[model samples]
Target chain A: MRPLGDDTGPAIEVRGLRKLYGQTVALHDIDFEVSKGEIFAVLGPNGAGKTTTVEILEGFRPREGGTVKVLGEDPFRADEEWRARIGVVLQTTGEFEDLNVREVVRHFARYYPDAQDPDELIERVGLAEKRNARASKLSGGQQRRLDVALGIIGRPEVLFLDEPTTGFDPSSRRDFWQLIRDLATSGTTIVLTTHYLEEAEQLADRVAVIVGGRILDIGVPQTLGGRDTEATVVSWMGPDGLESVHTTAPTKFAADLHARLGGEAPGLTVHRPSLEDVYLQMIGADTAATAALASAAGVTTEDS
Target chain B: MTVLTVAPARRLPRARLRRIASLGLYRGQLELLQFFRGTETVVFSLLFPVFALVIFSSMFDGEIAPGVTYSDYLVPGIIATGLMVTGFQTLAISIAIERDRGGLKRIAATPMPRSAYFIGKVIMVLVTSVVETVVLVAVSVVLYGTHLPGTADAWLTFGWVSLLGVTACALCGIALSSLPRNSRSAPAVVAPFAFVLQFISGAALVFTDLPPWLQWIASAFPLKWMCQGLRSVFLPDSYAAQEAAHSWQLGWVAVALIAWVILGTVLCLATFRWTKTRDGG
Candidate 1:
């Protein structure tokens, strides 16, 4: 097959994507794009449709309505070449129980035309310590790490990770994050779905907030829900006691406090809204908005 | 990406086809490795038929025909059972479990040709069934004076019959794997299904000794034909008189097995599912 799209276009594109699990609408008109080499994160709570969206993009699930293109080809109709360009790391999997970590990695490497060196990939994912450990013998965290190694062994052009690092320790998560960053720098597009908002802030170039089967917002982590310009909570020790103020400009507030003290302000701290704060606030707002609509409809009562 | 001069929508180039074939070979090799390494399954599948043969040979120590001993009859029956156990029961249960584990879905995500998985599974089935057959044959030959096919023609018959039996049973496994609701229920569903078939198909019970209704029912299935085909090779020509037909219907046996192979292929292609996601997304 000839190349699908120009290298400059977005690596993944979705528009008006809709999915239903029987009668229940699982995803409603979801929309987004992951540009080439960009690390895009999807943030949502459990059952908030993050996995559904990611699965659809990964060609693991079918959408009832909408168009999706990963690497400029519809994933549902993608050929082997199209498939060779993408990789997926699901939440958890049980496979190769009899095979060791090294064997499993090497097994997956055979699927692609151009694959990463299995040993180097295992090392990159920090499975070197347990390279010979049987899959069934691995701890929960180690199993998840092996899954990550398998996902990247194909050297895919685009990778999909759904709640990766769930079972990882702090250091492992850090190492995994570094590995992701390295992959992105080498022009691998990544779409990550995570419940951990800090992970989104840490690795995602852009983040999408999906709630109740709909996308609430999509922007850079710093500006998601206007986090960059939104009010920052600044606190200081005043003459009376401790004082806190919400201001759009935290630096000016801190400077004013510094001037008032004619020196460094004691216990003075400036804090902007974190990505987690914005995510939770967005989810809370969506909940509140639905509740408001329900109450406006007389608390779900039928009209007489 | 390599630029191509001619554009064909679905036709793969020769080199890619070769690569896919080689990849499937590698996948098959790994599958065999995994199967042999699996201790519990390996031991159970390998010995179940041999045990049945030994028990039956001891229980029925009389002449099946004038020159044919019960061991001669039981060897072929047990070989048929061995093929079914490896090709049908074990394969179905293992595939169900693997699908539940997301292994099939993971493989589906790769650029790996769909044929690679089937090739791998078929190779495992073929090799294990042959091994199961050989172990049962050797045990009968050494311990019970059971004779093997001495002539080249008889040996060729054995080979083709064994190959067809394995192909039909493996396809049955692939098709019926979708019947189980989930992995936990697979063994429960597949084992009893195979168990009842063996009894009715004369692998466990004597085909001619059973009632005409059971005989007719057995005749309709491939397992009975497989046993009949094997019995013709392992037993003396006089033993054909003991068959339900009073003669070895090798022609009808081949037809039934080939028909079942076709049916199983259709069902496998039509019903094989990579994932059974009953939980709402």
Candidate 2:
């Protein structure tokens, strides 16, 4: 929580990071930067090296080759003082055995130089009602909430959340997103990895898609893979029954359709590509085929 | 978005040690709570030694040697076995399970010093060992009429020997836990080995008439010395005649237990891991 003299500096910087398990490479030449106060999300399929990257950043795993700096210090060589400034929520929830939610959170709080009050953190993570419940007795989603509470209780300058909302219910996921936003607004740099595209799209200021041990692309979620400028889809019920067209200019196409119909076009809709569409395309997949499948199901790609 | 004022990070060097100690104590307390909550763990740690003492003593009413009831002689040995169970078996099995379950890995990710965790485990094991020993001794003295150590010298010997034995066994347990592939396999590997040592060391039965080679093998392990040292405190001085060396050999017992303590410490440092897949790092 220290006031960084130059607030403009990136909170995390990784360059040419490489890792290998025997002959199989886990990460190959990965590079990314997360600016201070940004919510950065890393999206990848299973075995795509997302966890490897986050683990390296959290100082949990040693990288074979890379120059990685978190909070302007090499995480691999960072001391306890350096560690005190960073918080990590691992994919696996830490089992507290007999300790209750509040006890687990409060026990972890002492490890930090500047920690949030445990009671406030439990409430912030929406676990106040379950604060006295034994950690193992809580449901999976509640345990994940406890994981997040422990992560942020450190009052870290940077927080690493590895699939933080994996088991959260829809409403709790939304609540978690709001909590993350609140943290980012308070200038806490958050780097999260998640398989949920909607989560990345909703939470990340900038997102990176990684596949096959490498980064496929990194950009603002809306603009990745030129999603913002991708040809929009125009759909309507026409004379033939239903018709849809993908065009660079949806407004002109819709107007032409309305003029041709001589009045209000039934079911007229304009839709740009969604984050999932751009993500699938960036990962070297055929989104057009998925669009066809949606069309066959009477669901327009625009509706998706 | 409301811009909240971030508090300046303050380093309280003065409170750091206090914080670490408190956290370590908290962790120890949690471990003890979990241990007592599990009925199986409580039964195994607290009652197993007492049960063994009763069954063995009732089965063998005769003396193992002159002037020493088999029941009285077995009291100290059972106390030694209690130490091994609490310090060795319990520690190894729990650590393996915790590692398999990602508990240790999660603690590694936190800013808590790794030493604090080991310290906490040591504290938990030590307290459990004390409880086990006290219960076993109290039961033996009351029910079996086993003689308690009388002199200050006997008490001092009992204190140091039990302390060193528990420390050595606990460290060895932690080191050996790293060898098991998972928690399920941990007891499979450690229990048989512990049982073999207890059997040969006369903790469960008298192995005095065994081959010299077998006696030497048992002596190489700390449990034998632990049992012998405890017997020196509780049993009459004349009971030394029944021992392998025809004397208490307290000096050799001290040397062997101390050596294990040193070796176990080194092995634990070299082999211990926060997770099963992760190495020493």
TM-score of chain B of 2: 0.92
Query: Which lDDT tens digits does candidate 2 get at residues A1-304?
Result: 4336545668998999998877778888888999999999998766677877887887767778989988887776666766778888865544575778887887888777688899988988888999999888999899888888877887888999877887778899899999999999999999998777788888999999889888988999878878878888788887788788889998888788778878999988777777877777777678896642232111212210
TM-score of 1: 0.89
Which candidate should be chosen as best, given TM-score against the real structure? 2
lDDT of each: 0.82, 0.82
Task: Highest DockQ: give the candidate number.
Answer: 1
Give the TM-score of each candidate.
0.89, 0.91
- Judged by DockQ cut-offs, is candidate 2 incorrect, acceptable, medium or high? acceptable
Residue ranges of candidate 2 with Cα displaced over 4 Å: A1-8, A92-94, A284-287, A292-304, B1-19, B276-281
TM match of model 2 to true structure:
0.91
Clashing pairs in 2: none
Local accuracy of candidate 1 as per-residue lDDT tens digits, A199-231: 888899999988889999999987899878877
